[model samples]
Target: MISKRAQQLQPSATLKVTGRAKELKRQGKSIVSLSAGEPDFKTPQFICDAAIEAIQNGFHGYTMNTGTPELRAAIVEKLKRDNNLEFDAAQIVCSNGAKQSVGFSLLALIDKGDEVIIPAPYWVSYPEMVRLAEGESVIVRTSFENNFKLTPSQLEESITEKTKAIILCSPSNPTGSCYSKDELAALADVLRKHPNIYIISDEIYEYIVFEGDHVSILNAAPDLKDRVVLINGFSKGFAMTGWRLGYLAAHPDVVTAVSKIQSQETSAPSSISQKAAEAAYNGPLDEVLAMREEFKKRRDFMVASLNEIEGVSCFTPGGAFYVFPDISHYLGAKKPNGDTIQNSTELCLYLLDEFGLAVVPGDAFGEPDGLRMSYAAAMSDLEDAMNRFQEGLATLTVH
Candidate 1:
């Protein structure tokens, strides 16, 4: 029998949609996929060149379980230069990916029955990671009116004695909303009252901001630095998704705890990927900036196009690549085939099956009134996707 933990853990919802789209493509269907979470851009040539050099130099051997010294040093410099945060090498732990870094943080901090506050709509893996750590997830629903951001009042109300930590994702996935400095300050004020609670700040999408700058909770509350586990990687920003390299910066004790688990579980991250990421931190940002500009253009086009669809309202996100449009107006509508679209999941499936347009359901991210559409595709693909998406919705008959 499978372990109960294995049985209870759900497969990634985003990957499921992507998998379905790929399966249809294998059958020669013209599928336009808008469900992927990673950037569509190729990893910059400079970063790849560094990886090649590492291989040529025979840098295959593993270093410390924590991370290679060069990579850790690069991370330290990058954190201070980019985030206005300071961290020593001893306080950093590198892992397979930002995903694993988050899971490791949860494992290190959470004991049985401890609670982690998650604001919805969230990245799908968060609650599952908490569950894997034997921690209860306290999901607080945010409002579309506020751009899907958690208010300070909501943060305060959600906290309790059992609360172990709260996860904050700016330039958020699915919603693409970036928190402002003032907003982070407000959340920090609430967090200050509860010093016992840790903050897991995920800044994996830090370099993709379009409207404004990406700000971490630590920037607002520097006093809380000792308790904040700052998570980031080279995936989204550097288009190095396949590299599987990420790291965390926290107090030395937290780093030690995470390192202990990582040492036993996966050992260190790849030596070659670490070298590539080091070059990413030290190399020029021209490619990264260019990608951001392209994403901004795509974001503008997607939001405008989606809003023009009757009953669909998309909030203009400050950062990230996804747009979560409120599709609740189409709920309870009947398809031409006489089937009812009862929820976001069904609506997404209808778009995929009928229109060859693949998007993720908001229900998978703890919001059922909307769905997530990624604008990370090429402009031509996005245009075609928009047409299919609009046509799919126009055909539904609302009761």
Candidate 2:
């Protein structure tokens, strides 16, 4: 029998869709997947080279429970250079990935019955992470009119005595919406008044922005540095998803608490992976910039093509590789097989079954009127996937 905590947690929806797509492919079907959040590009050569060097040098052993000194130093320098925030290595805790970093923070901070405020259309793991920590997740839904961003008033209204922390992911997972500096300042004004509520700033998509510079919450409200836990990793920016290396920077006390949790769990990530991540942090930006440019091109093409579809509407996202489109117009329409299209999950299943195109439904991300598609695949695959999306939607009979 599973523990109650395990029973309450939902498996990641993105992974489920990705798995289904892979299964279809194995069954000899031609499936185009837009489901995974991973970068399509290969990990940079220099980073890989570091890993090989580590192997050759026999660096394959357990590292410090927190992290290798070199990796932590690189992380500290990176935060200063990129985020304009300062942190000592003592305040950094490396984990298996940003997912673990986030989980550790939640476990360290949340007492039973504490509430974590999460914006809808969030990454699928946020709410589940809260549940695993025995904390209640309070969902705050954002709208298309506001570019799917949480406004200051909306945030202010969500806070309460039970609210222990708020998770802020700019260049967000499903929506790809980045908060502007001014927007962050407005949110900061509300957060400053509620000092008891901690801030979990997920900056995993930091280097993937298209429009402007990535803005960290600490940069927007330097006064709250003591309470902000900044989470980042090498997975997205360096195309090192398999490396499983991420780190968190917070107050020394928070870092210590998380380090203790991590010690008994994963201990340290792969020794080779830590070396590769250190190289990533200290390496050139050429490959990362190239990947960003490719993603931007895909974003432009995908948004334009999706808008051209009859019943679907989409907003151009500022960063990340995903585009969340409003597909409510097609809901309740009749399928050719006489089934009725209802919510986003039904729409996604219909698309996959009839069109062999894979996408994650918005219902899994806490918004039922939309769907998320990742453009991290090749340009040719994206082009084909969009065409398949249009074709699939056109098959629905008008209600």
Question: Which pairs, if any, clash in model 1?
Answer: none
Query: Candidates' lDDT values, in order?
Result: 0.94, 0.94
Tens-digit lDDT string for candidate 1 (27-123): 9999999999988999999999999999999998987898899999999999899888888989889999999999999999999999999999999
lDDT by residue for model 2 (14-119), tens: 9999999899999999999999999999999999999999999999999999999999999999988988888999999999999999999999999999999999
Worst-scoring 10-residue span by lDDT in model 1: 210-219
CA RMSD per model (angstroms)? 0.7, 0.7
Backbone collision tally, model 1: 0
lDDT of 2: 0.94
